[model samples]
Target: MEAKDDPAIIGDSEFTALLNAARQQDPEAMLQLIELFKADILRLSKVIYMPEEDVVSEIVLEFLEFVQQGKE
Candidate 1:
């Protein structure tokens, strides 16, 4: 799939905004980020033959933790 046509491919500005919000510990923004990239994450997990639930959850958790760490 073309990157431009991919819903998982967010614009740079949107990504920056999401990163800022995540660093601020905004739950809604964090959820939005997860929802926005969920399809791509799941697809990747499947392509790698990983369990979707476990992989996705770990990814989300790690992402949140990483963002939170930026505040420290």
Candidate 2:
């Protein structure tokens, strides 16, 4: 079967496995993951913290640092 048809294709890709683990450890995963989740996170933050829009960038930067620290 082709990779597209193979259920195990993702498990065999180094990057995919790395990302899956990273996502579990870090809610934001990496940069692209941040982009993917940014909308949801921003909406949640608005509800809980009422943070300014500009604060989204700052919060994401801080979260990335925190996640990286835990990995090391």
Candidate 3:
């Protein structure tokens, strides 16, 4: 496991494994994935939406809906 405040990590395989583990609901993996993508997701949410700003919760919910719908 990584330190709680390790700040940054760099490695494709490590990140890929982290993502895979997150899909399995490993808490640490989830946290890591969130930490990694939170900024990116927010940026994407902003770009995809209208002039109205998006809150964090809304961004997450929108992303969830998009992903869920895509899986169907």
Candidate 4:
């Protein structure tokens, strides 16, 4: 299923809050945000022929690092 079709994804307001919290380096929010999009990320990775485990790990780490950097 597409990301847009995923019922588990947060609504706009909650998404906005999550983004804000992530930018502030809230680890829990960052994790929640990642989990929220995990399926979509995996789907995209598969479409591009990337190994699921490696790609997902790389993406999640990169995202977390990016968010952490923004707070520095």
Best by lDDT: 1
Which runs of model 2 end up more than 4 angstroms from their true locations?
1-29, 48-51
Cα RMSD for predicted model 1: 2.9
For all candidates, what are the clash counts? 0, 0, 0, 0
TM-score of 4: 0.66
Model 3, residue 63: what's the lDDT?
Answer: 48
In candidate 1, position 5 carries an lDDT of 77
Model 3 off-target regions past 4 Å?
Answer: 1-9, 42-54, 61-72
Against the true structure, candidate 3 reaches a TM-score of 0.50
Sort order, lDDT high to low: 1, 4, 3, 2
lDDT tens digits, residues 1-72, model 2?
244674334333654555665656644347655664566668766765545665787777776666556542
What's the distance in Å from true for residue 44, model 3? 5.2
**Residue 11 Cα positional deviation in candidate 2, in Å, after optimal superposition:** 8.4
Model 3 deviation from the true structure expressed as Cα RMSD, one decimal place: 6.7
lDDT of 4 at 26: 82
Better of 2 and 3 by TM-score: 3
Per-model TM-score on C-alpha atoms: 0.66, 0.43, 0.50, 0.66
- Local distance difference test, each candidate: 0.79, 0.59, 0.62, 0.79
Write model 1 residue lDDT over 23-70, tens digit each, in one string. Answer: 887888899888887776777777656677888888889878887787
Off by over 4 Å in 4: 1-7, 65-72
